[model samples]
Target chain A: MSTASTGKSLAFTAGDGYHDDPPLVAGNLSFHEVTDLVALHTEKKTPMAWYGAFSIANIGLMILLLSVAYLFWNGVGVWGLNNPVGWGYAIVNFVFWVGIGHAGTLISAILYLFRQKWRTAINRSAEAMTIFAVICALLFPTIHVGRVWAIYWSLPIPNQMEMWPQFKSPLLWDVFAVSVYFTVSLVFWYVGLVPDLATLRDRTPLTKKLRQKVLGFFALGWNGANRHWRNYEKAYLLLAALATPLVLSVHSVVSFDFAVSIIPGWHTTIFPPYFVAGAIFSGFGMVMTLMVIARKVYHMENIITINHLEKMNIIILLTGTMVGFAYITEFFIAWYSGSPYEQYAFINRATGPYAWAYWTMMSCNLLFPQFFWFKKLRRNVAFMFVVSIFVNIGMWFERFVIVVTSLHRDYLPSAWDYYTPTAIDVLTLIGSFGLFFTLFLIFLRFLPMVALAEVKMVMPQSDPHFYEGHGDGHGAAHDLSAGKPESDRGKS
Target chain B: MLKELTRETKATMGIYEPRRDKVYGLLAEFSDPGALLHAAEGVREAGYKHFDTHSPFPVHGMDRAMGLGNSKVGYITLVGGITGLAVATWLQWWTGGVDYPLDISGKPFFAWEPSIPIMFELTILFAALAAVAGMFALNGLPRPYNPLFYSENFSRVTDDAFFLHVAASDGRFDMEKTEQLLRDLGALYVEVIEDLGTEQGPAGDVRGEAVEKAQA
Candidate 1:
């Protein structure tokens, strides 16, 4: 279960003269051990560090509440909104939060369908992150509408005069896409939690009758009947299948909000895929940022091992490269098209007033993740942590570059102006992080952060042939890929 | 003859019911999924119909071992998806094209190209909804009580233990013989599950009666 590879060569498996494949659950713990370890976080006395982190998060939440209240009182004019640069920090933050939400669905839905057993350990908390990020994302559009009271007019419902929202607008499409994504992701997350909740219910002491009853009610009297699992597993597969496309479509629709417009920077066919790639890049960054701390604070190193972090770093490398490719491709197309405005937009992004923001994005997103190509650097906890922070910042700048740089320079030179975020804009952005972490900390304290039931199923003991002494001759010390259930094996 | 007829009528009407002390089934515990799966296959091969295996997580190939066909939840999901597609199409067409048409920038009203995102979202939304709902419905979840809960050892089924329950309702059920059969199939421990003092009726009716008793 050691995460360190001893082989001199970079090989994937032990059989081919390379170091052994690192384990998913590093300690070779039993099912009971896993259950106890995860449940302890929720059942035990609150940790001192948890109190420290929670207070910090609460301060952020307070700031968010105050800033939002101020905005509502004074109106959108209080923030920095000029004539040419209409879309500002509000749109940038909205996109940033939504991008952060994608990692959860990717880990939960896409990875499950691909039979990646390593996903079991982190999927639960990652999905929780997705839900919280979406909540923060939804806040922007609602408050940015200025007339929050009349936001219902955006729905399909007819107003007093029978006029409906413009169906052709990408803005309305975004509403439907994001709402459905949230709803489906919630159901998927809850369905996965049922069995784990049952474990908590069963383990509750006699004195905590209230806690037991609450968990039991939510557990829905689950008895782990194979008849139920037969349907439960099928439902899970179906949801995963549905969510895979749903995740892809959600961000593509968001991109359409920009692509459908006639702006030189926004009106490009590659925007959909480009945006989707950028989203996944940023989402994984956020996941790493939280997970690095969560595992250490909760003493979950065995469950979420260095091997898991290494695998995630590889993904970051791949997606970061894709985003970088899109950045270059945009410049190429601008030059190839011979359109003066498109050329100017791309040139201006690199050499104009916002050149500092553009280069910061390049180095943080493109240059920093390149370190992950070296196995040692990616596996080093401190190095990945710093890169993840850079990823978060760079992605925000990516959105900023897309929204402000293009809008600041319109067709007329007289309309050109540099847009800077006011104190409110900066406070609101910081406050959104406050909202995300507040909900996340509460989840960590209350619910099982790791998916206990799913993790157990990935252990060697869950294999039917394991007890017969013929479990691939690996004994109990097998890696996660080796411990995959029989039903998953034959398919591939 | 008249007395016999009255007794039959009362039994049918649920007025005459068996005592709660009756054995519900034989509950068998296994050390791991392998043994439990082998026992499931043994039970199925023995032609025992009302038997089920329990564990913390779903065991692979369990359906085949227990002689279960593919789950019917997919059919429900398919129907839900189709309904969503239809509804989304109708809503967009009626609101934009037929009801109150708009001529903004000379774009057509209710085109399928622009409507694809909404349609796709709704399709996934409804399918996911039906999949979860149908799975719960098929599994008969949220039942306030089950006779299996009467066995103290069965509590571990949600954690480290594996279990098999053969219902007394099975046509082939014989209390002593089934217990022996489970032991032969290598159950680590076995116990007789009994229906304790609870309402002896449909799950819904039992829930209603229990709630009333609690309120009183």
Candidate 2:
């Protein structure tokens, strides 16, 4: 009781006993220490491992570039496109990358609105991932159009050609939806980075004049004015609120690209919700994959502790379960509808030509995450990392099954053909990952990977009343036990 | 004078103003947020109108302590959202139904159900843009030449320390009295921030004085 009043205890003393929830940030770190932990990665000399990874990513980017060039030089004919299967790896990769983009916004926007303080540690990098993933996502659609030059036809801008894109079409909606998603997400990420940029600007040594100026320019000369913080906080809140619905809508619109069609497997009411859940599932998986590596490489084990990894695992389990439920519901509805074509589609997915892909998706997305049900497995970094990789593979196959399986064998048996991706298709898919990793690795090198200011705000020292009942014990007490868990005060 | 000139180079481009000898404010750096919060309350209680607190992060209860009400950024966001909705609707309706009508599946040229996605996306885009832009516009940021930056200790406001500044523009501001009041509030450091005049050499003396006071 005496220790509780001192405000030095890690867990608050509830009525019965100690309520010891795991701290969001491990280790008793000071504000400056947290800043140093994140900023060091950017400020210090680039690690050899970063360069190694960057080179590999760049090679992927090169492959992507060459593939796109070849695709343009020839046409969509370079890939394995037939009468029934016009949509191939391009659409699957588009949906797959777009799904990966969801977790960042989910972490930055939805979790923010919920006041899940733990999001502070991971949100910045996650948002960056979202931006890069969306970039990769947008790449497919842009290049997918055989005539990349006339892509502007998708827009509503009046031109010499008086015709407008079909406004009623879900494809048109996707163009607007994805582009707007990218723009708003960029703005949100930048806005959140401003304060942190200012910190970096101040810390920059005078010797690095150019670095300081660049950081200063983007920082917008932020002075940490409370007046500014008032408006800034409101703006952040508003953006988060807007992004929450937008995140859900973006994926739904993506699913519309398929679900709006009359294809038996694609035409289902469950697609939108299912797609959104699967996007979040895949996104968290990607975030977990990157985070596990980044935290280890950057020596940020304290800031991004096992607790954070476990929490992400919990989300993975929840979304993975939702995705599996959707799969069953879609199959059940197909049979329940008594539509022969629909029944055939579902049956073919499981026991037909593409059954291998379907089964692979079922196991990876549905069964692999089941390991997270155990506390020990969820906390095991290596195990979670492997499952995360599986999630990525499974989610990609899920899209592949939906797009190719449905289209390859449609309403007519004569249209049935085995769809195999050409080497170009494989190269382009691999290249998109290169582009994603390159952008991500660059972000790691230049920017504060963690939200320093927000992390500081969560530290106990940020509380205006932290020292009210205590004496000289405040400094050492806070330094040693930084994450005193907002207590039962309920503000966090 | 070198200090003042060096600080100016860091100011945001295209907005440098050279003013004659004038006091920017008295900046008091507190060791922790609690001290700054209490100090802000004290300053408010003493009826100062042109005072602001600065910290590495937004201290909870700071707005109320500083008497700032709910931010107006939300209103700006609302306006932006409505504008986006209206524009998206008009763009879709006029372009699809009236300007260049298409007969697809015999569906109506214009309908709310089909238009909802675009409308919703634009609403969010515009609202988010307004929120960020409105916040920057209200803060009068990107004006890098804040006189407070001239104080070396002020840099830490973006780091670990908390600070409060009572502007010289305040109606009740008295230099000595404000400095003494901040000290009474147990500020770790108090220094007079000056807007260096174009007539420079003597500014060096003022800079030295500020540094001495900060050290005290």
Candidate 3:
């Protein structure tokens, strides 16, 4: 323990030491680098595969819009909404979109708080996914009211009509919850974009003055100062902390829309946490589906990285397991609680007229993510893509099971009636995919897919050690006589 | 004019000759941050201002040794949170209270329990917005240029380098004395830095230069 004249130990301590090696420069794509990206998007024209996908999406969107128009022009009676089964595909899609929106907030907020560096690569895209998914979700609830123009009547304000929204209604809670969720998520997404927008502002050679002005305004004149970096980091951390709870609460409130009801399967204590887990599971699945396509099309494999995809797969697996657990626990509780109605509801879900949907939900949400337990399977992009599709399918069925199954069979046996989707319902459902993809495609074309500044922060070469060895015997003294040369330290 | 006037005044006042302080020691490099932090603490204890430590990354305790205080971001977040809560309550009250009231469900109007979700969301919304906005405000962002970029050696910040700069701005900062102090504090190299007086250029050009330097 010989202390140097500097009054610090000169001996090397292996575990307690801090290695300040330079950040590794994997590679960076600057603004100029995006020319290749633009070329791929535009000059490549529409590939035969993309053409098919786009056409399918467009057709779906058209059908959906047409159905919506029909609903608005005609009424809710256009679809199969009779006595017992009031809610239909519209509500199902709303829940599904809300669930899909979960992955974005989870990726941006939860993972960010944990200081998961891999999040930098995928957060931007996921945030966009959340926003778009929410938009898609809002459509269903708005149209589901039948009288779309009278949607404002649901608000709590004292009006000339002398009416006020019911304080106890779960639907009203949804109104506030979803709106607030959307607003906060939007702000979070925009704030995150500020630094990146500045990067883009500097990078894009927009000859048009309006483009420059608009970009400049959005960028908020970010200069990336040290003080700015410090504040930005703090703000980002705080936001992440705020958002973490919001993510859990929003979906739980959505679950309350069903759980608060006395309608057998809908009224369960486990719905909140279970819904949140299922939301995350399905959301991650959507992320996987989108990421695979985006990475391949944009040729951004280096930035997106295998590590990111692997981490996402892990999340999918964990959440999928949680969903499976919830499913089991719901059944077990129903049987153990000795509630005949609960038992009947669970049984009806499995062996009823909509048993196909129930099984689909079970296999897709539970069985697909299990493949990720194997490293080889998790690494297989195509396999993961398939699993992701299955997860989506399962999540859709989960909503279907919650809605259609519960309503199809009530306590009053005389009121029980088989419900089936009209062709318009199916077409409208297909059109939602079109709406989602169209928005996504537009986003991909314009926005920076990757958060460049955040990624730069994580690169190895950004470490301070590269400048440590300059000057005197001080370098030798600091090396702790571990016998490793300065050159060797630099190499490592 | 200011420099000449200062020199003349110093000569007239007969206080021109500054006291010479000599420091002597062997300087070393710190590739490991723990060593750098230890050295920083040692220097701080020794009452040295002309010495600094460099590392490839920011060590957890390094700021304390460097005499930095806790970041003020929490204050911003707190204010943001309050604002969010207020706004959320107000929005719900206004919308559900005054904007439009309908009896869709057979429940009382202006429900507070359901409003909790919106309240929670707004709080987070404001808090997050404030955090980001506060960060930009505090950090003085959108500054496209910095004086540090003039030094080619500063590029190592993005790579592997932890540097403690003992600028002339410090009270103990003298050419020889600072160099000797750095030597005593285990600095591997102590170099005198000159402030490049190119402040009169157009802001855009300066920004371009900074960008070019960063890219380089």
Candidate 4:
């Protein structure tokens, strides 16, 4: 895993090449002080800015609830969905939220496997975002099925439900895929939170009994016993291992919902990998948007260092380009397939009715992220935030272009009709953001925003010191435990 | 009167009970991970079986230093995964081929190609659930109270200090000798925890059950 490039260079890492900056965390922080620093946020009253953001998020939540109720009350017709354009804003928003959810798992699970120490500062918040985004994503498909009450029938539950869910259908597969993803992510997030919660509990000696009970309850009696830590670390690694594959499959199955179908733009073989990449792309964008604001508001300049932002931007740049590549590949396939409908479906996307959305997606997802190629811009917080916002908007449009554009003009020209989202559709989409933020805000308010213990682990002071020619001169010469676990042994 | 009644009810419900007994075990605190790790090695080498170390996080070599074996959570996940695959495949075959067969597309009633996504999802579902369930079952969690919580000095285990607790139940545990040993090993603070033998209280026997299960 050492960065050594032979021959022609195709390098991904920015840190591998450039940027000599301060340490990841700012200020001379001792290991003992991490608990106190993070606990300060929870112990103190909510900031005025927090209240402002909270109220805004509350309004959005209200909108989301009303929209869901209205959709159920009146039916799917409340939105602008119809025969030709059946998969409109609901599917679009679902995919968008799901894509946004990807960065959390990528940061927490994938980066943990890769031993990316920089991720420690932002991983907790991103993981929370992932959970919240998934929650929003789950809402779409459930309510999209007009008879929301009959949604249970879609699941592969047993004898009670008259109809068994069709195994072959990608839609039914989504039921299993999404639910499993949610459960696993929730468990992973909670388990990671346990040690931090215990720290909060221990530090809050001056807090009221209610606070004590709450923190203690969630801390799960974790005493940081080495035996417990051993098991906990193993469990964490196992969850991370499981989650990496699970997150990939969850999105791949989502892609299958379209890819398995006979629709022209939807039926491409590249959808699985393409969707996963784009999900990571969009996920990073959302993470960037949050981290930029959070690091500032929480005074985490040192912890979420500029280098961390630069590294993330590099990922955003990479994945955004890959998505651009997928777009080109799709066009090549459409032309190569020699089918008129397939050709027409893609060509229409570029020059057809929804051409504005298509171009917007191209500009936002592809062009905007390419700015990160310059180190100056990537490190520039304001510019990165703007680009991240653009990425979010672009990714949403990417899904919209895929779902609505492909479906609107199908095999029969007679059935072709323009699909426009009703007010409820617009409001609902906005409302999902509300739900995401509300949960995220609550998380930020109560929990340690950064993984304090994990962040501490990456600190230089945590490592064992070797005082040469001193007392116990070489602490265990030929230290067997020092190396990575060889076949899971402590020593010979 | 109302407030007093509420307080009385809360106290009786054990909500107001102390989080831990002050007398848990002998606590030895270390300033750094190295010191703590060295102390763990010393404790392990001295043939103390019932002792444990508490720290802010999992130190890299603590497991090996403590002579602990690798975790068995993987075995549970593997078994659960295989079960998921078998059950999902069988259920799919029964539903699509045998019980309620439908051939709308003229493909086989039971197609493995189409079943892959759902099957993969189920396998992961089972594996993930097992991993979490195994973790909880292994870690002995949801125990909100521990005797360590009672010690003022021990609370810093999640903060700055490194700690090793030698249980009185350990056959080799002699109070003065243990304290002297911990001090020699560079423990900044050493507190011999007295076992009052009170009711297990809110911490429950979850850890004990998990440890037993793991051993068995």
Which candidate should be chosen as best, given lDDT against the real structure? 2
Off by over 4 Å in 3: A1-59, A156-159, A206-211, A466-492, B1-71, B83-115, B136-216
lDDT of 4 at B84: 85
Off-target runs (Cα >4 Å) in candidate 1 are A1-19, A470-492, B1-21, B197-216
For model 4, the local distance difference test gives 0.80
True-structure RMSD, every candidate:
7.6, 5.7, 9.9, 10.2
Lowest summed-lDDT stretch of 10 residues in model 4 chain B?
B207-216
> Cα deviation in Å at residue A489, candidate 4?
40
Worst 10 residues of 1 chain A by lDDT: A1-10
Put down candidate 2 lDDT per residue, A1-492, tens digits, no spaces: 011222233322111113434555566566767778888888888889889999999999999999999999999999987889989999999999999999999999999999888898899999999999999999999999999999999998789989898888899999999999999999999999999999998888767778977887899889898988998999999999999999999999999999999999999989999999999999999999999999989988877878788899999999999999999999899989999999999999999889999999999999999999999899899999999999999999999999999998967788789999999999999999999999999999999999988988876556766656654434323333334442322233
User: What DockQ results for candidate 1?
Assistant: 0.41
What TM-score is obtained for chain B in each of the predicted models?
0.80, 0.84, 0.67, 0.78
DockQ for all candidate structures vs. native:
0.41, 0.47, 0.17, 0.33
**Residue-wise C-alpha lDDT for candidate 3, range A233-317, written one tens digit per residue:** 6677777788889889888989999998999899999999999999999999999999998888777775675657878999999
Residue-level error in angstroms, candidate 1, position A20: 3.7
The full ranking of all candidates by DockQ, starting with the best, is 2, 1, 4, 3
Of the native A-B interface contacts, what share survives in model 3? Answer: 0.30
Q: Using DockQ, give the best candidate's number.
A: 2
lDDT ranking from best candidate downward: 2, 1, 4, 3
Clashing pairs in 2: none
